[model samples]
Target: MTNVSQLARPHLRSLLMHVPDGILDAPTSVGTAVVATIGVGLALRGARRELDDRTAPLAGLVALFVFASQMLKFPVAAGTSGHLLGGALAAVLIGPWTATLALAVVLLVQSLAFADGGVTALGTNVTLLGIVGVWVGWLVFVGVRALLPKRPASVVPAAAAGALVSVPAAALVFTALFAIGGQVPVPLDRLAAAMVGVHTLIGVGEAVITALAVSSIVAVRPDLVHGARRTLAQRPLTIREKVPA
Candidate 1:
């Protein structure tokens, strides 16, 4: 059999260069519309929650923030500069479902109004930002809470870690899609590794931005944070479990 090390090398690099730059088509536009509709429903449902009353405005703010953030893309080593995939940060701030809706609105406005991302590629962007970003951010928050102390002090770390992981996760998803439908003829393994590696660095930026945003909110109103609520609920258990141990 081919050596495992040899096998993985090419695929890693593939992730970095792989972009669906040329695949924009009719289906992509329709896809965005569908996500926007679903996203609207999810947003409305979350907004009905009492907590969401506060979180809803944050959602709008998130849309605005994402719009502005994308405009100031920083130079990555790749020819492609990267921007914040704020879905995870948003989800961690509010909730995952609400985040999905918020990012969808951001994307819709970007495509139809601002002409930022390709109107034909709205599907790709939504899948990357709306779906992938939410899950990555949420999972990282859950993980940080599980690994760290249960005190409210852990909020920044958990959010920072969540935000850090969120970016590369989105990058990996894009890498996968690019593998299937990439314009460039690059090896998938190399592409994945390159994408993951660089994005891992970019994720640091994502982490910093997300952590700052979460900390600002937490500082003003800890009760407004859904992640904080979970942390609080799990607090009493830490002492109980510690006593048993």
Candidate 2:
């Protein structure tokens, strides 16, 4: 059997990292930037509708948690490492609109302060992880929750499934961007397959982490979990009546 330490060593060497600039043609990067800008604008509008004094503080806390969690990388393959995008976790904890804003903030901070991703590629990264990842995961979570029992316990599994699928979906979006304007000379089919395969493994980690975090929060404060809030509210109040003794 392969040693677990050997599998984990590559992740330790490289801290949190993402696609750098100049890997894709200018047109692709610019196009993605436009889309990201629009997405952020829409998110801002949506957040206005969703956030209140009570929930706004939770959004800030979720952003900070996501930023810190992203710093830890884990091995996906022999040499490739991936970190939590935190899109699904944020969406489930807060709402998708707030989640998008939260993730965008995290990415912006990482790029400007730590240089974790390229400046030019900021929009691309935001489009892929912040917008696409959050929305896709949110959709999946909603769909799954609709099919399951409307209870807080169901939120964990739905969130986990959403996290599992979001990573590969984002990977495919990256592959499509590469196909459009990749600097490297590689076959599109081969690149897409490789990207999807590695990211699927990474998705398992994403799913586990998202599920655990959501579950912990739900256990203590179910109302704070946006995805589970409706179910929580629907719960019937129990009342006891004293009988004649």
Q: lDDT winner among the candidates?
A: 2
Give all candidates' CA lDDT scores: 0.67, 0.83
Model 2 RMSD in angstroms: 4.9
Q: Candidate 2: misplaced stretches above 4 Å?
A: 1-17, 242-245
Per-residue lDDT tens digits for candidate 2, residues 1-245, read 01111222423222223667776799999999999999999999999977888889999999999999888777776666777888998999999999999999999999999977788989988998899899999999999998998789999999999999998888888878888988765566756666677778888999999999999989988988899988888889889999999
Q: Which run of 10 residues does model 2 get worst, by summed lDDT? A: 1-10
Per-candidate TM equals 0.76, 0.90
lDDT score, residue 58, model 1?
65
Clashes of 1: 19
User: Tens digit of lDDT per residue, candidate 1, span 33-130?
Assistant: 47656766766676566244566676677778877886666665544356677877777777777777777777778778866666556666776777
Q: How much is 191 displaced in model 1, in angstroms? A: 2.6
